[model samples]
Target: MTELLANHVCGRWQAGTGPGSVLRDPVRGSALVRVDATGLDLPAAFDYARETGGAALRALSYAQRAKLLADAAGVLQAGRDAYYAISTANSGTVKSDTAVDVDGAIYTLGQYARWGAALGDARHLADGEAVALARDGVFQSRHIQVPARGVALFINAFNFPAWGLWEKAAPALLSGVPVIVKPATATAWLTQRMVRDVVEAGIVPPGALSVICGSAAGLMDQLQPWDMVSFTGSAETAAAIRGHAAVARHAVRSNIEADSINSALLLPGHGPDSEAVRLLAREVAREMTVKSGQKCTAIRRVFVPGALYDAVAQAIGAQLAEVAVGDPRSEGVRMGSLVSREQYDSVQKGLAGLMAHTDVLHDGRRRALVDADPAVAACARPVLLGTRSPDAASLVHDMEVFGPVATLMPYRDLAHGLALARRGQGSLVASLYGEDPAALAAAAADLAASHGRVHVVTPEVGRTHTGHGNVMPQSQHGGPGRAGGGSELGGLRALDFYHRKAAVQASPAVLQALVPA
Candidate 1:
């Protein structure tokens, strides 16, 4: 009986042209909605964004654009209940987890608004008195950042639909560029709802916010030189787009946020008796359970000192086992279903491959329900792998089993742990669990080249730990090498990408005349 939503192309809701695909509840194998792009007018959508939406956004000043984004956030905040009811069918997430995707979006909007205010009126390049080139006193110079001449295209991932869309959307709108959002097929319904609310609120220009629910066919073919493209998903997909022939020919700027084998290191001093050790285990388990470990930033590896490997593994295993798994709607279920049976199988296959390289320390293998059908939802327990291989990089570093699966490796010292952590080529984040400031600093600096972000965890940060699976609005959430070399949501850095920069120089008299006095 649940009604599914469609894409918001141009100024209104639309249906696709091809045979539609059906979206199923992850907790229950029931049809949530049917989605398709068979009839979508891609050319018309692009034109509308360029001519209508892009015009209006560009017409407004930076502050004006931010006000529109803030208003859009207000609308989303008011309709969060609808989002929760719809999101419940996707996976098992606590209220806080949903907040990270839903409410966090509003916060991101606010952050972008603040960024606009900080940019000041003239976009000041350098502050100083003007130098006199001649006795007539005519020459001068100054720098400014301006908006690009086209729209921004955002292709989002499935896990945190609301957060992903808003994170990219907030910056684009704030930068005075309209946006075209293509939500991942798995969770397009949630994005549809939010976009619909945004449109109805009339916070932005009619053509400024375009949406496509299905295939992105013909979408890239019509891009202009001034436009920018951004994508978030697996490394394989990101690489494909970055290497797309059109992208290269058009010299289009592409930003990709890809999945990485993120890791966490537990220092040697943290024993089973240490509260820090228990806290680390708890944090690791929480990361696995939240969003059913569907996050691109999820901790796929755990590094522990050799002396505490057994204790760390056992503690983490027991905690992961105790996690309640079932329908996200059910009262006690702490972990939810995989995005789909396809993803569930992928997780299993990845785990099976990992088991070949490492020992299975804990197997939370069991069927979790999908809806009320009991056996329909595709679900699996978090798989824990412990490796004794002398070369951790060759065995564990190359193989990344995405899902709730994580491989725990042993190291002799802080230096050894740092070396092991870097074995994964590169990661989006690396978290260290220890109270030792010296050790944390040394290891973090050594591994800094491999990770984009690193968090040092202690009891003081326990309450607001954001977990290893979560990415904040202010952090750079992408990795290098295998993880994909693109970043998303690093405060103002996210906004500036939409606009192209060029330094203009001329004689003082000429520049003064160009500048509107």
Candidate 2:
């Protein structure tokens, strides 16, 4: 019998006693692990985090908490090799892709650790200078940020198990709140392992962190007014969580980052021969194959000038053609399989929906495997579809094929490209490629309304610029409308989500006492 993954509740690890959910390897379709959370006390887990964990964390100052985070990062960094091995079998990601999640998590923790310096020894953060509330200066009003007295429940997505857990946990811990992570069941093994590692390191207090390896039954019902629920997944799930009676009635603070049809645009003046055009093609192909396009920030829409549409399509197709998809552990395999058969089917369904309004340009459905059997593996080819009339192809803009699939559309000019990008309702990111800085600037200004972040690719920055899908710790990572209307990872701003700000109005002496020294 396969060993069931354990759930970390309170301060100890316990194996789930209920029937298990089989987690399969994406490359070989073999059962890797069994996950179950039956017989687990959901409310008791939260209570442990809030009372035991929260007390321990809250007893420390902001700087002390920050140092703990730094120490935890060191421990995880040392275990990178072990993490990569797990990711290869569980998530079907190439070594480089795994580095992005594993290393990215460590880097985010380090960044938060350094950011805590600005927070100083203050237990609570003062917002700004005091303002006179009355005619006399003796009476004034001030705002201060203090950590919530409740636990933070993080419901993460499957694409980034490690990064998702740490990114949210780092800030919550630093802000003096304990974290209870509910990783997506499909990829919970990696998350469970990481939590175990953190626990064994003894860097954090016992109940400071916990993991629910199976269903999140009765989890939301345990949320109090001061508690927070941070979620990342589909828009449909986000909406349902937001509407939950516990959240709506008690007004629990909830943050969400949902699926987005992110786009990369090629400016009109940048013809086929331009470096900007080549760069755009390269970026589009990279985003498509990276992690098999499971990323929510991946470019699902490609908008090119009407005159250069064919050129862009040919360039991207050629680039994608060279990509070898198969077992992630095999040599020379650039891309891997979808996370599971269910995800494979979801991608096919999304592809069929886009094909309803467009024609296939590069069919990724049939491809030569590197070292794995396609029949058993949950693999899909990187499909590139094209539509001449983007405005008429509502499905092309609205639907997101969450695999190695993207649509090539033609726009009349910059305005048309911006309009077409907005047709996704909203997105986490959008990229514009061109040599003309003025043109790129203008396009970015217009697209800013609909996108959380804009990537401007020029001849100079193209060489040094990070790829379009990469999210930095210094920048915000959420969008409006269809994209969840929440902000995350914007330097010190991220701490705001974990902490509550309140206005303190009183006499100068009383206000001074309220403010952190």
Best by TM-score: 2
Off by over 4 Å in 1: 1-4, 91-94, 118-141, 366-374, 390-395, 507-517
Q: Model 1 scores what on Cα lDDT?
A: 0.76
Which pairs of residues collide in model 2? Answer: 364-381
RMSD of 1: 3.0
lDDT by residue for model 2 (15-63), tens: 8889889888887888888899898877888889999999999898888
Candidate 1 lDDT trough over 10 residues, lowest sum: 121-130
* C-alpha lDDT of all candidate models, in order: 0.76, 0.89
Give the alpha carbon lDDT tens digit for every residue of 164-241 in model 1: 888888888887778899888887888888888889887888888878887777777767778888888877877778
Residue 263 shift from truth in candidate 2, angstroms: 0.8
